[model samples]
Target: MKACDVCGKKSIIQKSGAHRYGGGWAMRATKKRKVWEPNLHSVKVTHDGVRKTMRLCTKCLRRVKAEMAKKVAKKVEKPAKGLHFCFNKSIQFF
Candidate 1:
């Protein structure tokens, strides 16, 4: 049983309809059944300061990556306290 850790996505059975043609003007419709599997991949994920490997579907993986990127971007946009400087000599010390 293959399933996604993030979204609980699993394999499912699907049916498709097709038309069968016989002698002239005679036709019949039939249902074809097939198994559909989720696009799952093994990925390393960090949660609550612990890193672990998990099986995540593509959609969940994309969401996780986007969230990580947003967090990194927010950190990068902030100015470091040590890098701050003042022009005035007396004020620079405070």
Candidate 2:
């Protein structure tokens, strides 16, 4: 019943069987059905000056984290306009 709120990812059924090995030969047993669920986490998010909680999968969570990091990087102050710094030389303004 758990799923990602962002992407709507859900669980799936996987068919699997047991294998027996003997004398370099392999034998298969009766196939079984298994439920494969996505890795989901409950996260708290803030949007439009409001706080909310959401469920997100691992992939979506990673993407959100990367986007937040980019926002933080953009907020950081950079060198003044027309000013440049060189690794081998001193600072210069153009």
lDDT of 1 by residue, 1-94 (tens): 8999978999999876655454443334456789989999999888899999999999999999999999999888675555546665333422
The residue-by-residue lDDT of candidate 2 on 1-94, one tens digit each, is 9889999999999887756563333345667899999999999999899999999999999999999999999999876799788997898878
Clashing pairs in 1: none
Q: After superposition, how far is residue 73 of candidate 2 from its true place, in Å?
A: 1.2
| Model 2 lowest lDDT segment of ten | 18-27
Task: Supply candidate 1's per-residue lDDT for 32.
Answer: 74
The window of 10 residues in a row where model 1 has the poorest summed lDDT is 20-29
Error of 2 at 31 (Å): 4.2
Residue runs of model 2 more than 4 Å from their true location after superposition: 17-31, 80-94
